[model samples]
Target: MRASIESEDRGNSMKEQIKYGDDVLEIELPDDIIVDRVAPASHGGAKACHSLRDDHAEDTYEYLYGKIHQALIHASTRIEKCGKIVIACDDNTRVTPVKQLVPPIIDFADARGIPAEIIIAGGSHRKMTRMEREKKFDKAIMDRVEIMDHEWKEEAVFSNVGTIHAGDESIPLLLNRIACNHDSFLMGIGNIVPHSVAGFSGGYKILLPGLSCEETVRWVHYLISKFPSEAILGIADNPVRRTINSVHQHRKIDLLVNTVLDGSSRVVSLCLGNPITAQAQGASISRRVHGVPVNTPGDIVITDSVPESVDFWVVAKAVTNTKAFTRKGGHLIVFGPCDEGLSPMHGDALKRMGYDAPRNIRSRVKGGDIPREFLLEASHACQVGEVMEHCHLHLVASGLDVDAMASIGLHVITPARASSFVRELIEITRNEVTGRKPRVKIIHRGAEILPLQ
Candidate 1:
């Protein structure tokens, strides 16, 4: 839920309830902090993300379901004879409405006496636990189908599909064994949103980096680091996107389901058709819906990583999305309720490396000081490091080590009380004159919201 909130002066401070994941949190700002504005997860004109909720949810759902059903009907010849199908879906990191949208395909298959299994497109992220899976899909759907996840570490499970470029270097493009099965129909599912690496999320992403082998995942991420994020973030078809679309040449997926969600996590619109065309169609609406106008960059920008996520990895997204609004040499406050702690899969690699600028990391990797094994982690570092170049980042969250993050250029701060962290943070970062107030902007759903100047 988005927060229809405005900052209110409360004597010596200001208080406002902004979107904190699926809930709202009352953030008390010190008197010295000026709340210049607040942006939200889903946004367009009216104010923030909360104001964009589509109250006619039932109509929207029925409409999208019917649309998807129609597409499935056309593919009946193959779907009916196949006996089994594979459903590709994004992991929990995305707020995709999998529970609501996925069932249509499953039901279609079941009615035709066909079985369906779900493959979690985890990318290089860790496996989604049963609890996360439940949250990601319909509870009942879990019992009816076998759910599997992409294993980036297991070389044996992947089949070398073809070759894709990381830069000038050509790398082996590998996909899962099941994904290689051309006999069954594969339905790729995800929501479209602005993204730094892929231009926009969904489409070919749910297949290439989503279920690709370790080498493919690193190649995709590494290719993106070579471009400035501003060029890719919300662009319909950038170079990064064009390169990713190349994967479709190898894998012949029958259909793709890409939906656009409002700030309230309700369906705004959905595109169901060829993966490339559908993603392009959905991204157009996504750009229009998610693009929030920014008056000016803020002296202090506050962004949040919602609860129960992949820790700093999720926080890195919040940082990437919100960094554009932080004036150079300004402060960027990261509000992360990281229940999963620092990346469970890449924590060791992260701890060993610092959040150096992208060029520095690039130079070290080129010098062969940093090995190729941590290529994906290197990509993560470069994304986060890009933000550090423009602002002084202060990470305020749980499930993180203070000294560990501090050593990597992240100034970690935690309050004795959760409610006091923001206020205490303001006091500690008082770089201005004693009587001066600093301008602040709060990006409620920092990981998904896009700010347009």
Candidate 2:
């Protein structure tokens, strides 16, 4: 039988409620016990390694899951018989969502006679195909964690009470059903960002996608990630901010631990305990350490140290950097650090454009009607050699065929010689042209050419 809630500290409680974004959870504990769980977004790489260490010192020498295991151990150690513990985490195969990290934790928790239920938190969110879910979260966690039925539940919302102000808008937070509660410390482990909702990141959000249903998740994602330019993943005023506010109201999760990332997405600093306070402290460090803006563009420009991800896809991200600033044909110099190959979409597009790539790319403008054979022929037309011959292409590559570029009658330079060549080109252009030197553009890491006028 389910237990009913009763308040104990009626006289001493100041305000009976508080706000998180748009939602408000109770100020007084509904029961004598309560537990809040938050699992943050995971971007695998070096940053995660550093982030793990900084947040939990005892587990600093331990790997990512080591701390997670400790949290489980702590929760299990404290909760008595019938006392509840809720764990929210990503479906990542390696470190979370219980199956991978829990067997040991669960076995430990179970041994202590504490029963636990796992809940999938996505509600009305798009459901992951079973296969997709299985691949991401191993069967072990899937089996033990109680997957919340996202489809049938009433919409989750925050109570209207105290609100956080963002510009002119005021978001409301509301109380929701009690999932689990305990007197032990409330723990939140994850990364933080300037989200569209929940003001700064780190808090109630870890559970939505981490535990929610696929359709519920998909629906929310569609809204949050809608306009790419208007809403970056970690930017403000995006749908996520509103949603975050709507669900987590005045929960006052005890501890929020996170990492600030660097340019290579490395974790340069760590923030722990109390998101309201910790987020403010970490934001400063993030800006100073990893927030270098792209350089201002000039006419004929060369970009150095561009991310290799630029060439990985047909949709080049360079347009976002300086495509508008660059003048057509006016030489955009690219520096390469790419040992990895180009994006398949990009390769396919090149092939369809008559470049000699293996895959046939269908034209987006033609609505996939262009035959594959035609695409192959077009692929042949835009070969690297042909592009160099027709357009004023200057290539500086480490392992690329520089001689082939020279044979095609275009300027070619080895990686080492590029700086001098650029310097000479600048000198020659400045001498020929009168009024201020024509802008010379240089891109450090060149992958794909963004055709921006």
Candidate 3:
């Protein structure tokens, strides 16, 4: 029921002309930019509780336009028709400037002799569906930007295949797929959260599902969260990581655009050029003001008082990764308000993991044992739901009493202990050990922390 579409009245203020050098050009944009950010219907509590406005919306748009415009200028004056302009984006928005707003603005610029074509940075993700694809372009600009025929280029890779043993079903990890196949070109990614695996943001993620297959998306998401190599760092050099990068290198990536988000998800800093290099610099800046350091010591660190405006996806990312900032023995304190634990697609993946009730628990207790593969399948499922709640429903519907956590390989800390209550948990953890060194790490990634952009 929130405002999914912005009206025209909100977009009318910027019709004037401006001069840069001797050439004068008019800036044109929809007065009200309608944004429809999707949140889970059943478990929207965590993200819904936070403020719902895009605090950095205006600045993000301006920066995006500026980058395209600058690139257009360079392409027009210096380069020729053979040149390409690629803009990398994610599911964050259906309305893209290049596909929706830029053509008209560029037409005005073209009056001043600048010409450019916007190509979808469909490097490594799935293509949008009919309905989802419609929001990206109007009739006119849709013609201007070229949509790649398909999302991924299928390629077979010879590697050690392993089975993700979820429940009883063992899914195989197979070959690699590349999204875009360009020899060499300039690349610019929009923005993303600072993840442990990719290190900061804006590498080749915008195209993940959009370019990769369903299984590919599943594998990448699963491994990034549960794998051990992440602790060592520079895991990008690993075989799986290198293979993914090789696909991008094949595209001849030249420049990278990365956006830094404040705790409030505002665009505080924008870094241009060199994806990895820019991300390192931008992420460092992001942490200085918004990142809460790991300083406290507790068996279970409960992050209470989370603001409502933060999305569950970002919330899950922050809490799930708390271990990275926490001492080994400590558990995480998640104050998530949502009851539904995973995204819709992610939930489906979890179900596919095959969590039938275990024989032992089915007869003795209400709960069931879930294999690690089920956990891996459901790892990214923690969008906002409690795993127990989801499991309970699944069990009752399927007429099963209990499940095992081991079979699925997912280690959920649900059936939350009574001691987990923030006040009690803190007291217990704090009081247990004598002369215990306080070493706790808390990251304020949710909406509570103000956005730096």
Candidate 4:
């Protein structure tokens, strides 16, 4: 809604507009080559409970409250004591409509005579600003319900909830104190997307990286950093997901109100139930919404990390799913507008290791070349390195530290210069190649989809 997509023709050339932050990128492609693009698909935007699905009734809250009420009633059946409940919501880094859906949860709590509060499971991202909070929940909802952000780094607020073994490693599980409190019934709200971590985001993930302590978060990230991007990016079930589930079981989560979003981040489907079964059901719908089959590979592929575009570290997620879209020896461009620069938390960590191959980084970590504090981000760097090895990777990032990006092996181009650069590159590549027309495909909002064959 911020800006309209406009297209035009310049004699045997194609110009298309893509959104970057608030600015529109008017990229023109040489018509001599084959041009194709695909975004994440949307369902009819239905609501589901258990195995049942239905159209969005006018009384959306009734369906939400009914399922929640039934579950809560069932949970409280034998107990006489008045219990407390907590609704853990995802931050703006995800496309989840946490603000819109939270009020109804509060109403459900009130009706059940249980005190309720909302915790933003930000997962080590920057704290949400007062302005951001206001925009997220509006003033009325903020005043009506208690809302607070999870302090992942604040050691005082975390509790060591024992340890769990993932593969051969036994890791200490530290989680948010409030979330781990047995007195509070947990209701986690999030959106499901094909994720590099946790197989897909939702289910028990609201506890793992979402509300877990700093070290625990780092451990999970580093654990999966061992695998190549293609090995785990779009997979629905993987080692990392199983590990997260193992860690999540330490805390008791009753209900998971997970959603599936379209390319535009609209809630295309809503799922309600416990984290395990509900999440499995939810991811199936998410796959349908975000999965795009690709029989023909593209010579040039572009993707933008919409759900998390704050910095190069997070925005590089566009490269995760879209890697499959780029054919071997093709070009991949990622538009990452890093508003937070490199990272607010990891000081010079990514800069120190930069982005490189997985085997090299793993060896460096083993040899203690990378500081213990930076191992978490080193996993992310491995992803970028994996992309660089297969194809020519270009980053169209505006706020990245240019010198650091260069040193780290990223071919970064500013948004202002991206159009001309892409056009010239396409023309040059076309001139050099013969027999077959090269393919150009741009995936808008790449964070959600799995580009499947």
Q: Who wins the TM-score comparison?
A: 4
Candidate 1 lDDT by residue in tens digits, 25-55? 6777777456755544443221111233445
CA lDDT of each candidate?
0.75, 0.37, 0.37, 0.75
Model 3: per-residue lDDT, tens digit, 1-453?
Answer: 120111122234333222211222232322322111111111111111112233433545655566545654555532334344444444323112334235534453456543344445443323456564555555565565544333334534212233333223344433222224242244555553434444333455544433444455454544443343233122223333433443343343455555554444444555555555555565455444343433332343333223321223333443433443334545454443333333323444444543332222122222424343343344344321222222211110011112442344333333222223333434554566557422222223322221111
lDDT of 1 at 368: 80
Off by more than 4 A, model 2: 1-61, 69-78, 90-108, 121-124, 149-153, 156-189, 193-200, 207-249, 254-272, 278-290, 297-453
Worst 10 residues of 4 by lDDT: 1-10
Best-first order by TM-score: 4, 1, 3, 2
Cα RMSD (angstroms) for every candidate in the order listed = 4.0, 20.4, 15.5, 3.5
lDDT of 2 by residue, 321-342 (tens): 3333344444544444222223
| Clashing residue pairs for model 4 | none
Deviating ranges (above 4 Å) for candidate 1:
1-12, 18-26, 31-34, 41-58, 415-437
Native-to-model Cα distance after best TM-score fit, residue 108 in candidate 4, in Å: 2.1
Q: How does model 1 fare in lDDT?
A: 0.75
TM-scores for candidates 1 onward, in order = 0.89, 0.40, 0.51, 0.92
Q: What is the lDDT of residue 241 in candidate 4?
A: 81
lDDT of 4 at 283: 73
For model 4, give the RMSD to the true fold.
3.5
